[model samples]
Target: MTSYTLGQKYISPTKPERGVFPLDHEGECKETMLKYMLCLSRNDNKPSLCQAESKDYFQCRMDRNLMKKHEWEDLGYSNEQQRKT
Candidate 1:
């Protein structure tokens, strides 16, 4: 389940193909939905950590890696690490 920080609250994912609109972000909802949809459209399957909130908003962020896979490998948290542990 999505988590929330003190300032930011959860705005559930929506049909992102519709495009990002100002109304959609009123009061600081999840703006990443739009970004995520756009990224998918670009064929960028690489996941990303995204967030949306006003100065008074708060929310937790997901883990996103660059298209490059070396970071996790260096940290020993690679997908293989999960399987091995």
Candidate 2:
């Protein structure tokens, strides 16, 4: 028999088209995601080590108009990385 869950089943989000931003974009920002992949490879494939890279990658996406605008602040972290000076 199958067991029922209280919440919605964990369905993976839709990925961008294969030849789209971050996937087919050019320039240094494109490497952000690559950096994450490298980190993951070195860190026993752990997903956490690549978070920073993922953030950069997403920021790049927004900057390039690949994703919707005005969503960076929400998607970006609390800006704790920013310095007061």
Candidate 3:
């Protein structure tokens, strides 16, 4: 007796063509990913104040391994220090 379909729509058969901070690593963190995409093009776009330039472009793509080293609380982040004493 297992009926679970609250909104049945799930898709994740590992179709990950690389993109969590991947602008193809933007030629190795191009100026901190252009200041986190210019703080997401301003206009009061406060994405948590651009989480310290999005944790310095995901720690420069995990130091050139190109990804896979996550723990700013599993990327939900709280302190990677862009600015917020």
Candidate 4:
């Protein structure tokens, strides 16, 4: 399996490289990817979405794209304002 070593640590999922080297490995699966993306900084030392939820919260929601309500909330827009813009 292809693996990436970030410094001394190994990157999981053994995903395909840019331009599609291979897609056999799936360690960095959709769920892992979403979790990483959603982890975009909340604040300085502030709790992130992962920090606040139940351990299995994301475990169940993994791989699903962020919903409209969440996307709007993240953009600092309400449902009404987001639809208008």
How do all the candidates rank in terms of TM-score, highest first?
2, 3, 1, 4
lDDT (10s digit) by residue, model 4, range 1-85: 9886767965588755433432324444455545544653543434333343222233333333222123435534456644553
lDDT of 3 by residue, 13-57 (tens): 765653543456348777887888899788377767777777887
Per candidate, the number of residue pairs that clash is 4, 0, 0, 2
Candidate 2: where are CA atoms >4 Å away? 1-28, 70-85
Q: Which lDDT values do the candidates have, in the order given?
A: 0.36, 0.64, 0.72, 0.40
For model 1, the run of ten residues with the poorest summed lDDT: 51-60
Which parts of model 3 have CA positions greater than 4 angstroms off? Answer: 1-27, 35-37, 40-47, 52-56, 63-70, 74-85
Q: TM-score of each candidate?
A: 0.22, 0.48, 0.31, 0.19
TM-score of 2: 0.48
Candidate 3 clashes: the total is: 0
lDDT of 1 by residue, 4-85 (tens): 6889868998764422223432323345555555555565554432111111121112122111223434433457544543
Error of 2 at 47 (Å): 1.5
Best by TM-score: 2
By summed lDDT, the worst window of 10 consecutive residues in model 2 runs over 76-85
